[model samples]
Target: MSAVIALRAPLDEDLTAFVQSLRSLGVAHRVAEQGNEQVLWVPDEQVAAQVRELYARAPQGDPGLQPAHTSAQRARPGFLAQAKHSPLTLLVLALTLLVALLTWGGDNYDAGRWLSFVDFHIDGQYIYFGSFAQVIDSGQWWRLLTPMLLHFGLLHLAMNSLWYWELGRRIEARQGALMLLLLTLWFGLAANVAQYVYGGPALFGGLSGVLYGLLGHCWLFQWLAPNAAYRLPRGVLVSMLIWLLICMTGVFELLQFGAIANAAHVGGLIAGCLTGLLGGLLARRLQRR
Candidate 1:
């Protein structure tokens, strides 16, 4: 069914992400070959007109397809579509995945050393982690935050990544990328600090603490402001809290499971909840205004 909707010369590689948008929308169309440039083809003229209208109204850059006005026309965006709107969240996910790759799912200590909470020296398969004070004295302030990027295993990385992808994008969507990045750094620092304080130079890392922070933030923010962005189900937040309590009880450690950074989780959760409370209040005031 030849249905060329419109053509714009020279579609570039950037359109790859935009293609995900069409897929998410169930558009049932494809971009023509390079010779046809940005031409779109669909099954029939009606959908072609819809595409034309969407393309015509957009200002620039992949037709700037905004969310549909009606619920029926909208589809919950796929991964790429979400990534397009939430670049900061996508970047965190990418970095976590990249670090996992570099560390060989947390087994390659030598490779993952630099990404840890503290700088370290290795001698005879034994790692000597540096002190936090030393890191501060050396002006290596990044160490304070880098620990959240380290995952001890694939499961560690995957679980943290899933939650972060779900929650980080919520913050990025609601508060903007800059705000999301800043909050992430803030939560990461809290998590790292608490882990260092409790575990004391042990090899520990993961985004779980930051995930808890995000969960807490969304929990309290929605509680206070009732915005759709932070509207998570009550059961989800309760389950996370229950899990945290279970971790704190040391059952996992006793069962030969890996060490759980309870302090980091608590610290990050406190920080996130505080931020949520303050941010929610501000949002409510603004809404009133």
Candidate 2:
């Protein structure tokens, strides 16, 4: 439970240098404490204790070194683990469950009438609009946001909500809840608008587009915010790219998958990727200044 604290030298607060120095101390594990601080845990033996004392004798101003008893802290799940607990995920799952209940409860469900009724159509176009656009032009601009609340079927609701539940946890953990909420709305609305422009007035309703947007956001974040440690790893990016390619192969259409709007997928992805790049650059610039 003895954690090694960083003793930064005067004018030598480089995080990389500090970490390298810690590595030289033969510490096997490390964790960030805050900006410019870290805690390194080492076996508490006489030799290691001597090494710690010697390292603490740097000529720079006295930076305190304390043995933090982490037995209690390490015994329980950390913040990230607790934040991502299944109950939080269940909240999103429950929301989708409610939507599915309503969709299935309707009498007209099998007739395809109920499904078509909720779908968004661009006026005079073959492409589907995001439910947002239809709601907006129909003088229910408020519905632009609420239409995302609607789900057509159990599978549809389950897929979207699962994505929201899983990815939403990671996004919230990295960017905080407020940023995740804003990004959800931004990607959802922007992609829907993009679909209307590109798909030429087709009624579309689904969260798949927003899922694609989140995928793009994840990728772009890796590129733009590499050092932020919040982006997806390379393996995830490769797998997602493969998934997108497969989706675009038209197999779903050939199989008669009804109302899967790939247009919204493409549109939302493009918008979110661009926005993620912008956000990363902005964050980097702010860090520099």
Q: Rate the local accuracy (lDDT) of all candidates.
A: 0.78, 0.56
How well does candidate 1 match the true structure, expressed as C-alpha RMSD? Answer: 11.4
Q: Clashes in each model (backbone N, CA, C under 3 Å)?
A: 0, 7
lDDT of 2 by residue, 90-187 (tens): 55446546655665622233332233323433345343434535544656553344335456666777677766665666666666667776777776
**How many clashes (backbone atoms < 3 Å, residues ≥3 apart in a chain or on different chains) does model 1 have?**
0
In Å, residue 225's CA in model 1 sits off its true spot by: 0.9
**Tens digit of lDDT per residue, candidate 1, span 222-261?**
7776655687877888899999999999999999987889
Alpha-carbon TM-score of each model against the true structure: 0.73, 0.61
